[model samples]
Target chain A: MSEIINSPLLWKGAVVTLQLTLYSAVLALILAFFFGLLGSSRHGWARAIGRFYVEFFRGLPALVLMFWFFYSLPLVGIRFETMVAGVLALGLNYGAYGAEVVRGSINAVPTAQYEATVALNMLPRQRMWRVLLPQAVPLMLPPFGNLLIELLKATAIVSLITISDLMFRAQQLRASTGKGTEVFLVVLVMYFVMAQILQLLIRYLERRSERILGRRPRRRAATAIAGTTGTGSLSGVGGEGS
Target chain B: MPSSDTMSEVPTPEDPQGAPMDKTAADGALPHGSTPGIRFEKVVKRFGDNIVLRELNFTVAPGERVTLIGPSGSGKTTILRLLMTLEKLDDGVIWIGDRPLWHMPRGDGLAPANEKHLHEMRKQVGMVFQQFNLFPNMNVLRNLIEGPVRVLGLSKDEAVERARELLDMVGLVDKIDAHPTQLSGGQQQRVAIARALAMQPKVLLLDEVTSALDPELVVGVQDLLRDIARASDLTLLCVTHEMHFAKDISDRVLMFDKGQIVEEGPPEQIFGEPTEQRTRDFLQAILAT
Candidate 1:
């Protein structure tokens, strides 16, 4: 158990896993907003394209997508590095699910809000950005937090594409030491810790979004203590759902 | 259909005796060379299988304070909504000032107005809703300034200054930084009124603005509206069940029934001696409650 915990190789692999999670999360988030906005768009062609992307990616398993990107694409004269292939597969898959979250959050904004924007003579873009999206932020946070953690867990699948992630390192260590249980258990705890960290980050963002939107009371004391904290971190996924 | 002394020269389509409902009130209150405040030329609006408004022909003279008093589902609120562009007109044209609302000149003929045309027309109008519809995400000050800065192209500082003045007018300056959710229903509605005023709209539509308030709170809002009516040359189209408020504010009171005006005159004639039985019954039922 000590050796499994102490292994420098395992730490390196954990770094690789963390890198995968971060990169894939970023890609997924961009795609999520793109497809989500498109899916609910007034234009039929945009909605069709958005729907097709979401259904296509969501219907396929993340691991199978990784394999296709890694192996099959190369055979068809399209090549990607191992990590790039893994990130793309995970991003495309998770993004589809996140798009639903985005769409649902946007729709959940009251009809009255839209009407008010119209009454104010807001252009379509202004209505979405200024009114609809700001209101939708608090609603999008919790679900996105969940999706982010799910994306974190899904990074384990990158091991199959020979990315040398935490899961892959654990198998290698188990093979060398002939101790499957110890190696697996340590890796499990590592993954769990990473997920917990991600969850805490998301919770912080949810509170920040609520505060900005004035749905929750502004914690003057906390603001004083944590002086000048910027809202840059969650601007994409947590900024506005709708 | 004898014209009231204070009534503007609005063309009355349903008048048995074709009173020249032109832009010439006997009181001479209407300005010369000004466009009609609002005019519906054989307008029709239907919802699904239900016809809400049927060839609703009426006109509100510029700067005239008109009240649409009717029972629920009589299409009084629908008229306000149509002017505000919240509802699509199924047929005919609605003119706001000199411009057609739902249609625009295309070559030698008229076509359905596109978004840009509608937006330009909407800029001249504002509305206060029953629900207040203040943006929950924004504070009172932000709500007031949003339209001015965004749509009216006022500088942020100019918008804020205007917002402060409007907030002061509405008696909500103290609550400027407060969220819409934090204010009472009446306070929220005041903020909504201020928000609308920030746009400096020429035509104001009031759709039961006090209906959603608590009974005790309705009076204050009505008094504020009365003050606004007294102060501005704005064309006011009001839909309210509050007969006393309607009487206080409206120069011409229209009694609507089944999507048509059953009677219209000065407040005294409509309230004291309604020519139509429908108008009498509706007023009796409403006033009794």
Candidate 2:
């Protein structure tokens, strides 16, 4: 247990794992927004292109994609480093899934919100940026959090591609120390810890968005305490008043 | 990505005629008791196989207050939606301030209006929905100021100042920083009204604005709207189930059934001395509940 905990090789592997997750996560997020917007675009060609990318990448398994990019592409004289290939595979794969999440979240914003923007005579760009995207973001957060955790777990597949990620280090430790159980348990705990951190980060973002959007009940609590603040009534003049 | 660049391709035949009218109808330029007149000529709208508005010919005078009353699915709300440019016209033309809405002039023929034309026409109109579609992502102040700041090109300070005035007019100045969810249904509706007014539109369309409010809350929104109507020369088109609100707000009441006007007259003639049996039936059916 002590050796597993103190192994410099394991620490190095963990650092590499963190780097891969961060880099690929960023890549996936950017592609998600790009393809997602295209998927929801009004243009026929843009939506078709978005659909093609999402379906093509999502149909292939991430490990197979890594192998193709790393091995098959080199045969055609188009080669990538092991880390680059792993990142591209993971990013493209998760990005396709994330694109669906983005599109769904944008659609989930009620039609009336769109109408409100139009009623205000907002340009299409203003409507999406100011009203649509801000509202869609909170809806996207929970699903995106799930995807992030999945991506963290999926990084283990990179170990098969000669990346010295945490799982790779664990395997080497198991072979040399002949203590598969101890080494694997430590690796499992490390993954769990990383997942928990991601969850915490996502939760913080969700709370912050709620605060900004006023979706949180903080104002309601305040309104209740302040009793007569919003109680102004218009009960006279027209017979329409209850 | 929707741009007005296509407008350059389409000849602005209405430009010569639309310019002067636009100047008078521009933000805060119209006289207190007059704005723009809306004319619909043979306008038709269909939802799938269901024809909603069939050869709908109607004209609203400048600063006139008109209420469209009909039973559910009579296409009363559809008329407001058309004017707001929320729904496309299946056939015919809609004129806002003497300019065609669904069509643009092109080489001695009417071409279907592009996104740019639709957007340009939209700025002249504002609408209040039954559900009070206030942007829940923004506070009352932000909601009121968003249109002015973004579309109207006012600075933040100027928009805020205008928003404060409008909120004070609607009596929600205290809740400027409060979220839509925190307010009551009536409060939210007021915010929606103020939000619409911040744009200073020439034509105001109210589509069942009070339908979603609590019974106790309906009066407040109605009262606020009544004050607004009396004070501004905005050409007002309203759709409502409330008979008294219809009577109070409308100078003329158009009773509709099956995509056509069954009867139209002063509120007194329509509600008190209805000439058409369908109008009486719709009134009785609405008032009974």
Candidate 3:
């Protein structure tokens, strides 16, 4: 147990997981914003293109894309590092989903606001940044928070591609200590702890955004400073099927 | 339906009323700043199968207060939209002073005026919408400053100073930092009016600017509009259901029906003893009280 805690290999695994999640999520954000904007634009061709991207990438399982990016790219002379391949797969897969959230939030801006910009004679770009985007922020935040956590957890799958990660550390502990129960349990608890912390950060940011929107907070939520969140991160997945 | 009282011997070349019309309001327009803004020259507009303006013609002298009244869809709001360039006329031209606002010369010959021309023209025209479409996300001060800063290129200090003056003018100084949702309907319209005034337009369009207000709240807004119109050289074009407000503020009244002007004259001639049965019937239904 003491050796596992002191091992530089364990730290390397954890660091790699964190780096992969951070870099991939940032890349996904860029893709999501542009895809979202295109998905909601007036041009029929662009919207159709955005729609196709969203459906294809979102429908393709992340693990399959990971396998494809790692194994298939080498045959095409597109060989890349294991970490680069992992982040690319994660970014492409998650980007399609984020595009939907972006599109829906932007569409939700009232038409009257658009007309008002027309009355102002705003340039197309000015209308987008000044009017459309600000209205979109509060609507975009909640869904995006869920995506962030999903991206974080999905980093675990990169371990299959031989990229060291937290899951790799768990396997190392299980093999050496020969205590699958204790080692696996510690890793699971660590994941639960990380997810709960992220969930708390999202709620905090959501509260801050809501306050800026001038919405009055509801009873129980307004009072709590630190609250544990259920796994049902996006909408109702946390509730039991039973 | 040109009122008989408007008959003249000068023979102002009859605007080929029967000709094929497209953007008739696009020509013979009054010059902006140099002349009183806003002119219509036999303007004809159609929406698909419906003709909304039938060789319609009118002008507002600088600082003139004019009110447009008619049944719903009488094309009153359409006229304002045309001036604001929100809608392109099917026939005829509209001019602000000497600047041709409705059309830009294109290789296709004459295209609808492009955005840059429209922005320059719009700088001289401000409108308050019926819905009081204030930016819901911004405070009153930012709302007033956005167009002046971005569209007109006014400095922030200058914009805020002007915004402050306009807020005080609208009796909303206390609410300048408040979000629009916090204000009552009257207050919101007042802020919207200030937002429009911040542009310092030569022609101010008010499209039923107060009809959406609470009944009790209407008086405050009408008074604010009257005060603003009185102090500026704004050619006021108002579309409204408020009969008394129109009579009190207008230099002339244009009565429209089925999208054509049925009668127009000085307020007394049109409102007091309207010559057309359609005008009389419409007025009675509206001003029955």
Residue by residue across A99-185, what tens digits does model 3's lDDT show?
A: 999999888988878878878777778888998888888788878888988988899998898888988877877788787776666
Better of 2 and 3 by lDDT: 2
| Candidate 2: C-alpha RMSD after superposition | 9.2
lDDT of 3 at A153: 89
In the range B1-289, model 3's lDDT, one tens digit per residue, is 7642242211322221232222222111212343245677678888988888777766666566779999988899999989887788788767677766787767755678766778777778888999999987788999999998998899999999888877877778999899887888999998998888787777888999888989999998997777666545467899988988998777778888876777777678988899999989998998775
Model 3 spans with C-alpha error above 4 angstroms: A1-18, A39-56, A168-192, A216-221, A224-242, B2-35, B41-57, B106-109
- TM-score each candidate: 0.88, 0.89, 0.81
Tell me which of candidates 1 and 2 scores higher on TM-score: 2
Ranking by lDDT: 2, 1, 3
Root-mean-square deviation per candidate: 6.7, 9.2, 7.8
Which segments of model 1 are wrong by more than 4 Å?
A217-242, B1-36
Positional deviation of B153 in candidate 1, in angstroms? 1.2
Which TM-score values does chain B get in all models?
Answer: 0.89, 0.88, 0.86
Worst 10 residues of 1 chain A by lDDT: A233-242
From the highest TM-score down, the ranking of the candidates is: 2, 1, 3
Worst 10-residue lDDT window for candidate 2 chain B reads B1-10
Lowest lDDT block of 10, candidate 3 chain B? B22-31
